[model samples]
Target: MSTQQFAGANDRFLRRYEYDDSWIVAADLGVADDAVDVDVVGTTAIVVVDTGDGVAETEFELPGTDADVAVQNGVLTITVAK
Candidate 1:
């Protein structure tokens, strides 16, 4: 398992876990699911979240180029192909 925490404008954190054929990246952002947006460029994943007060953005390296993103219960989950 790989874990990383980013300190920026807001309290944001990222966690990654290695699986058999894929990697799981999770971000804990206490916001609505519709307020989170994710985009992938090359091996990097860019995450943008609307925090009501303002917008917070962060980018991190992904294990692979292809990624699937989802948000649930204020948690952002991403699965990358490896």
Candidate 2:
């Protein structure tokens, strides 16, 4: 099977295309912070996870309130699509 690189995978896309605005700024969802880290070696993106820290990430493949995700307290969360 071939792998498709989503816009999220590209660093440029994340910094420029996806979340690009001057005056008007958008929330970094949950997984879009320098403090936060992620690893998508296989296929990942557009997902949401309950950080339990009063935050929620975006959802992937699923609509509205559904997305594959995981969360941690100290270390990074590992998200894999179901």
Candidate 3:
């Protein structure tokens, strides 16, 4: 599978990038650690963001297996086994 496969969800807060063997989901600025949450439920990747006003979320059906989720530098990177 390719990283593009992980970018099925379209939202204004998140940007998806395809890497050599990983998929990167970048959270927009102003999204703090406490404001955002990411999870991989089976083959689906769910991302929730909460600001002072309200909460927003996005979900994408991932590709491949052995999925891993990592957040660093204000970016969420999901690597999968394919």
Candidate 4:
């Protein structure tokens, strides 16, 4: 497995892991599940979160075309096929 770190807006960080067949990206935004939004366009992944104080947005390169996104316990997890 391989790991990568991405610097995000507001100094937030994203952790990425690569497995045999998939890639997983995760971040803790300290927000409710309903307050997060994720979008993928080609090889880019866009993440937007409502942090109560305001909105935060970030983007990073993705390794795959298809993605599955989820937020729980104020953590965002995105898994994509590789």
TM-score versus the correct structure, for each prediction: 0.83, 0.22, 0.62, 0.84
Best by lDDT: 4
Model 2 C-alpha lDDT per residue in residues 25-77, reported as the tens digit of each score: 11233443344433333333443334456444443331112223334442333
How far residue 30's Cα lies from its native spot in candidate 2, in Å, is 12
Clash-forming residue pairs, model 3: none
In terms of lDDT, model 2 sits at: 0.31
Give the Cα RMSD of candidate 2.
12.9
On TM-score, the candidate that comes out on top is 4
Higher-ranked by lDDT: 2 or 4: 4
- Candidate 1 to truth, TM: 0.83
List runs of model 4 lying over 4 Å from the truth: 7-11
lDDT of 1 by residue, 1-82 (tens): 5555555465566677887788888878888999988888989888888889999787888889888888999998889888
Q: Of the candidates numbered 1 and 4, which has the greater TM-score value?
A: 4
Q: On residues 1-82, what C-alpha lDDT tens digit does candidate 3 reach at each position?
A: 2323222334445455666766555554355666668888888888876766888777777765568777665466676664
Question: Which candidate do you rate higher for TM-score, 2 or 3?
Answer: 3
Q: What is the lDDT of residue 5 in candidate 3?
A: 26
Superposed model 1: Cα runs more than 4 Å off? 1-11
> Candidate 3 — which residues are off by over 4 angstroms?
1-30
